[model samples]
Target chain A: GAGVSQSPRYKVAKRGQDVALRCDPISGHVSLFWYQQALGQGPEFLTYFQNEAQLDKSGLPSDRFFAERPEGSVSTLKIQRTQQEDSAVYLCASSLSFTGGPLEQYFGPGTRLTVT
Target chain B: QQPVQSPQAVILREGEDAVINCSSSKALYSVHWYRQKHGEAPVFLMILLKGGEQKGHDKISASFNEKKQQSSLYLTASQLSCSGTYFCGTEMDSSYKLIFGSGTRLLVRP
Candidate 1:
C-alpha cells in the first residue's frame, strides 16, 4: 500500500460489546504505534510495537484495552466491554525504524469508534 | 504526560503570522510538529532533534530548545490553507514513545 491503512473507517458498538480494529502498517515498517483521540483532544499513545515484540503499553488506560501485532505487519486493537467513554478515534501510525533519530511517521485515516 | 500548549486557539487573518508554543515537564530529546485538517489524519510537518536547530517547510518553521523543553511552531504569512489544528509531539529522554500535546487550533480568515 502507498501508506498506512486502517480498517472499518467507522464503527459503532453497543456498550459491553467487543470490537476489533485492524491496522496494516507500511510494508516493512519496523515500528507501529496505536493512539486514541477523544473529541477535541490530541491523539494519546496507547501502545508501541517493534516488529512482533510489544515494547510499551503503559498508556493503555485499563485492562479492557488490548493490542497485538503477531505477524509484525498487521496489528489489531481489541476493546472488551466497550463503554461510552471508549468512543474515540483510534489512530495507527508506522515508522520505518525505531532508532533514536528523526523517524518519519505515516498515519492512517483512523477508525472512529463509537460505543453507545 | 501531555505537553503544555499555549493559546488553546488562535484566529489569524491571511498574510498575518502566529506562533504556537509547546512545553514539556520532562527533558525532551526531540519535538515533532504535525498539522491536521478536519476529517483528516495528522500530516507530518517537521522534527527538531536535541540540538537547537530550526527546520522550515515552506513558510512553516519550528524551533526547539533542548534545555528548556520547549518548541514553537512559526507560521509566516499565514494562509487559509494553514487553517487547522496543530500538534506538538514530544519524545522525552526517558522514553521512546512520542507524547502529544492538547493541540492548538488555528483559523485563518480572509
Candidate 2:
C-alpha cells in the first residue's frame, strides 16, 4: 500500500480522442517520472518532475502528450488526439533523492493504453 | 540514446550464476537496474552511481565503470523469482531522466 499507485489499469481510446492517466507517487518523493513502454521494449522516458517543477520534458514524443504534477505528489498524463502509435503501457516512477545513493525509483503497475 | 544490453534472452537453472551488462555510447552518470514480470510494474533491482555507493539486494551485485561508460549486473545464484525481463536505465544528464534499453529476458528455471 505504500508504493506508487496508478489509476485505470487499462484504457481504450479512439482515434482523435483524448485520455488522461493518473499517477500517485510514493509519499515524500521529490522526483517523479513518466515513461512509455511498448509491448516488448523497455520503458522510454516521457517527462520528469522534481517537486512541482517539470525539469525535463524533452522526452515527450509530441506536443499532444502533456504531463503535470500539480502539487508535486499526484501527476497526470494527458494525451490529446490519440493515435495508434500512442498505444503503450504508461509507467510512473518516484524517487526520494536525486543527488545519489539509493537512486532507484519505485514504479507503479502502469496503465496499458490501447488506441484503436 | 538508449543503452545496449547483451544476450537479449537467457535461460538459467536455479543456483546458477548470470551477468547482465549495460553499455552506453555516451558518458554515463549512473545506471539503474530493474526487473519487470508479465503484466506488472518494474521493480527496482539496484542503482550504481559514478563515484560509488552501489545499492542492491543480497545475491545481487552491480558495478559502474565511469571510464567505460557502462554497468554490469551480477546475479549470483539465480532463483525462480528472478525470472523476468531485466532493464538497464542509463542516466547521462543530471535531470534524472533515464533512457532504458530494450530489456533482456531472463528465465530462471527451478
TM-score against native, each model = 0.96, 0.94
Q: What share of the true interface contacts does each candidate keep?
A: 0.61, 0.89
Mind giving the per-residue lDDT tens digits that candidate 1 earns over B56-108? 97999999988888999999999999999999999876255888999999999
Q: What is candidate 2's lDDT per residue for A1-116, written digit by digit as tens? A: 59999999999999999999999999999999999999999999889899999998988999999999988799999999999999999999999977654478899999999999
When summed lDDT is taken over every stretch of 10 residues in candidate 2 chain A, the lowest stretch is A96-105
Q: Please, what is the whole-model Cα lDDT of each candidate in the order they appear?
A: 0.92, 0.90
lDDT of 2 by residue, B1-110 (tens): 88999879999999999988899999877798999999999998877878745556788988887878878888999989989999999888666788999989999998
Q: What is the Cα-based lDDT of residue B31 in candidate 1? A: 90
Model 1: runs farther than 4 Å from truth? none
How many pairs of residues collide in each model? 0, 0
Measured against the native two-chain assembly using Cα atoms, what DockQ does each of the candidate structures obtain, in the order listed? Answer: 0.67, 0.75
Span of 10 residues, lowest total lDDT, candidate 1 chain A:
A98-107
Best by DockQ: 2
